[model samples]
Target: MFLILIKLAWRNILRNKRRTIIASIAISIGLAALIFGDAFMIGMMENLIKTATDSFIGDAQIHQQEFRDTREVSMTIQELDEVGANLAKEANVQYFTRRTFAPGMIASSANRSAINLVGVQPSTEKLLSQIDDAIIGGGFFEKANEHDIVIGSKLAEILEVALGDKVVVTVVQAKSGDYFEDWFRVSGIYYFADAAMNSGMAFVRLKKAQQMLAIGPNVHEIAIKFTSTEYGQDKQVPFWKTYSQHGNEALSWTEILPQLPKVFAMSEYSKYIMGIVLFGVVIFGIINTLFMSLYERMFEFGVLRAVGTRSFGMARIVLFEAGALAVVSILLGAILGFVLTTIFANIGIDYTGNEMMGVTVQEFIYPVLTIEQFTVYPLAVFIFTIVAGLYPAWHVAKMSPVDAMRRSF
Candidate 1:
């Protein structure tokens, strides 16, 4: 019986070729808009997250309890190896390394600037951060290399320093001694996502920093990378709990950068608003098309009823027609949207406006395609399209067979 209904519905839709074409186009437009919008939003979010994590924070960080709470270097963890060993046992842990960050002044022959200097173990640093890949010129620090520094692109520009240029760094040591000073030859220049990070950050070998600052092996924090970022809060929370139990504190990327969640939240809310507006516009277009088709077929409906066809039967035919059109249109739209998004994902849209919040983003925007957006969005659109035809079906069912048949143009 259902198969027969579907067949009848298919034939009836074909009988009015123009009307079917218009309805299908309306549904297709709606579905395509939703799919594209979702893809673009998700893609942008992924890019932003990647940039932030790569430039500074890793997926997670471990720190001394007091250093985290007070931002004091004096309370740094001396037990680095013990902490690294414990973290290595975790299934999701990919790379772990210790780092010390200090505020210092850097000067070259032409320019001088205040910057944040980061001390890192070269091999472990490469495993935990994007610094190695981000180096645009020269080369990363080698374990055997001493008194060598890597500066951000902006910093290099400001300092007018090139690869092998000598620069002086002066920092206040933690031991309450007089200021410590050292000269380093620049070996690399890197460009990160944020202009501020590039302009105000420098990297040096951990041993060099330790010797210059008169500090021992104590490190301010331990940065970690995970096998998969998708594990996110679930993996980090348990690890933090375990570490806290052993007298240390653990923090996730989200905690290290508190502003990220707020940014993502705002973007998500904007997406919802855009989705609602698009959904309404599409629904209105579809409903208008369906209603017009119903009115044009009133005479045929009257003839059917006058010949003993039940009102429920008429409603069923209209609904089946709506469902069939929806399915066909949604499938077509989804295929087109997926193809377009995949193409754009590789090409990306570019923007060259003023920097936002210290980050100078590239001009290109990329769309990200996810299985949920491709499959679920089309299904939602199809269901909405079918529902939009309900009122028209109900109106057709309410007309009296005698009045409908007696009507003349």
Candidate 2:
């Protein structure tokens, strides 16, 4: 009986070719919008998160218990190997890098400024941070060692220095509580595209930084990155809880950079608002199409009812028509959306050398579609389509066969 009703609905839709075509086109366009919009938003968020993680804040970081709170040079993580072994044991951990950090004074012949000096292993940092790829002038760590420095473009400008220029770095030694100085030649100039980082942060070899600070083998921090799928999962919390012992503290990106999570939440809220507005438009279009289609079929409905077809059967026919239309339209929309997203995903939208909301894109932004996006868009459209059919079906149910036939003629 259901199959027969579906067959009848199909025949009814075909009978009015122009109306069905127009209605289907409207539905297809709406569905396509939903799919594409979702893909774009999700892709954008993923890109931002990736940039944040890869550029500096990995997925998580490990530091001495009071390190982040105080930013004190004395709060160095002493048990590097033990923490590293624990991190390595975690299946989610993709990579980790050791870092020594200090607040220091960088002075050139022309200018002087206070800056955050980071000590990093060149080999590990190449895999971990975008800083290596971000060098616009001079090569990364080429002929660069403990006595060489990689400074940000803005910092270079402030110091009135260029590549190969000698600069004096001064830092307070953690153990002795006394100031020490070292001279380094600027080996590379990098532009992170972040004003704050570019102006105030510089990089050097970890051993050199430790030696300069007289901290021996102690590192101030360990940055960890997890696999892509593991990012949104609160895998860091579990790892932190398990490993945050023996004066160790694990902090996720959300913890270290609190504002980023808030930005993500705001973007999600915006997407919801956009979705509601877009879907509202779509629902209205579907309702209008369903009403027009039902009015044209009123005579046929009344004839069927007079010939002993149940009132419920009339309503069912309308619903079946809507369902069939939704299935076909959504399929077409999905295909169109997928093709469009895939094309753009490859080409990418370039916002290079520009900062949006203080977060700069490494290169270009790519649109990525997830399985959930595809599923949710079609499901939402299907539900709205069924709801759209309800009003027309209810109108048919209220009408007497005589009245329906009279009105239709």
Candidate 3:
């Protein structure tokens, strides 16, 4: 019986090809809009997180509880070796590195500026951060030389220095709390394309920074990169319990970069809001089209009913027509969406100089089409399309055959 209704519905839809085409186009466009919007938002979020994490924070970090608040060289992680051993035991940990940081001054013959001097282990840091990839000229340190340093391109431009040029870095000693200065030759100039990082930070050998700061075998931070960023939030509790003790704490990217979660959440919520607004427009289009189609058939509906066609059957025909339209439209929309997403995902959308929420994206963003995007969005539109047809279908069923037959178009 339902098959017969569907056949009748299809025949009726074919009678008004223009109306059906118009309605189908509306639904198809809506579906495509949703898919594209979701993909774009997801891509932006992924890029933001990757740039923020790989550029500096990594997936997590371990620091003295007061280190974040005070940014003092003396608040160092004293048990670096033990903490490393514990981190090694975690299955999710992919790479880890020790770093010491201080706010200091860098001076050259032509210029001077305050900078964040970071001391890093070159070998481990290569795996944990993008500092290696950020090198636009010269080379990353092959070995820990006390005099070698990597400065950001912006900093280099400011100090009027290039690779092999000497720049003096000055920092306060941890022991005496007195300032000390040393000269480092620029081995590399890196461009992360972030104004703040590029202009205000420099990297040197870990041992050299330790010596300069007068702290023996101690690091202010231990940055870690996990096998997957997805596991970072889940692993934090256990990692903290295992590694953090008195005066120390372990933090996930979300914690260390508090703005990240807010930006991510806001981006996602904005997509939903846009989707709802788009769907509202689609709903009205569907309702208007379906109503016009049904009204045009009022005389035919009356003739069918007068000839003993059940009102229930009349209603079924209208609903079946809507369902058929939705199915056809959604399928075509999905195909279009797949083609667009695949093309863009491969090529990527580059916004090299643009900053989102203060995080600079130094690379291209690749849109991701998740399983939920393919399934949930189409399903929701399909259900809503059917619901939109319900009132029109009910109107047709309520018609008195005699009155409907006499009613003019």
Candidate 4:
């Protein structure tokens, strides 16, 4: 009986070629939109994370417990050699670099602006962040000890300085509280999408910055990059615990920027909201198609009822017809979604220099395709299509032979 119903449903849809094609096209569009939308959101979020991390921020950071809270120059990481040894042995750690920081003033001939002075190893810092790539004018530190300095373009305009121009750096010694000042020729100027970084930060070699601050062989911070971002995102991993000893604190980017996870959660809620809106709109179209088919066959249905065809069998055939239509839609939609996503994944969409959620977008975003897009969305469309068939099936089944025949021409 089930096989006979399936055969009848297939034949019934085939009888009206134009109606079947139109219904299938409408449902296919819905499924395709869902699949492509999911991929696009995933890509966007992933790109945001990459931008936030790679723009002078590593996947994770380590510091003395109070350095984060106070930004004090005195809170240097202890037992540096042992910490370096452990990091070298850790498989998940791809790159780590020593850094020192101080609050200081950069004085040009015309103006003086507050600065967050950073010390970094030139080679390792290049591998860890996009600082080298961000140099729009001048150049990055050619050698770690070259007395070269890098400042942002915004800060340059504020101070009225240009490449090779001389400037004075002023900071207090950590132990003596005595003011120390030095002159440096600006060798590089970098530009970042974030306004904060542009106007308030400067970078010099670790050797020179440490000398300026009078903290010999001691670093205030250790920046770390993991082999994969997933490792750094998991805060509970043993690598963090192992190195987070001896007055040091290890933190993933999530802990460092607490609001990022909240933004990610909100993005997920948007996906469900979009899905509901789409399903609600497409459902009406499905019902309209089913009703038109039912009314067109009213005379035939009345004939079937007069011959003692059961109500359950008539309802099952209509539901099967819905499934058939859904199957065709799912196939076409899946193919279309796959092709579009794959193309974008390769060519990418440029959103460079655009800022979002407090981070600058440094590169292009590519749609990220997943197996669930094909499976979950198609399954949802099939189920929703079957549910949509119910009202039309009920309306047809409950009609008496006389009423159905009278309504038909």
C-alpha-based local distance difference test score of model 1: 0.78
RMSD of each: 2.8, 2.7, 2.0, 2.1
Angstrom error of the Cα, residue 84, model 4: value is 1.4
Please report, as a residue range, the 10-residue window in candidate 4 with the lowest summed lDDT.
Answer: 139-148
TM-score attained by model 2: 0.90
TM-scores, one per candidate: 0.89, 0.90, 0.95, 0.93
Give the per-residue lDDT digits (tens) of candidate 1, residues 67-181. 7667654666656777777887989888888888777999999999999888898888887778888799988985367888999998998999999999999987886856889
Runs of candidate 4 with Cα error greater than 4 angstroms are 143-145, 407-409
Clash count list over all predictions = 5, 0, 0, 0
Q: lDDT tens digits, residues 1-409, model 3?
A: 8778878877877888888788888888888878977887889888988998888899989999879999988999857788888888889899999999999999999999999999999999999899898898888896556799999999999999999999999999996999999999999989888898899999999999999999998999999998999877675356767667866888888888788888788878888788778878888888898888878878888988888888887788789988888887788778788888889889999887898887988889888898887799899888888888888889888889988888643
Instruction: Give candidate 1 regions above 4 Å deviation.
Output: 66-70, 235-237, 245-247, 262-269, 349-366
lDDT of 4 by residue, 360-386 (tens): 777888999999998888999999999
> Compared with the true structure, what per-residue lDDT tens digits does model 2 show for residues 192-266?
777878989988999999988888888998888888535634753578786677888888877776776787788
Order of candidate numbers by TM-score, starting with the best = 3, 4, 2, 1
C-alpha positional error of residue 242 in candidate 1 after TM-score superposition, expressed in Å: 2.0
Model 3 lDDT-worst window of ten: 235-244
lDDT, residue 287, candidate 3: 83
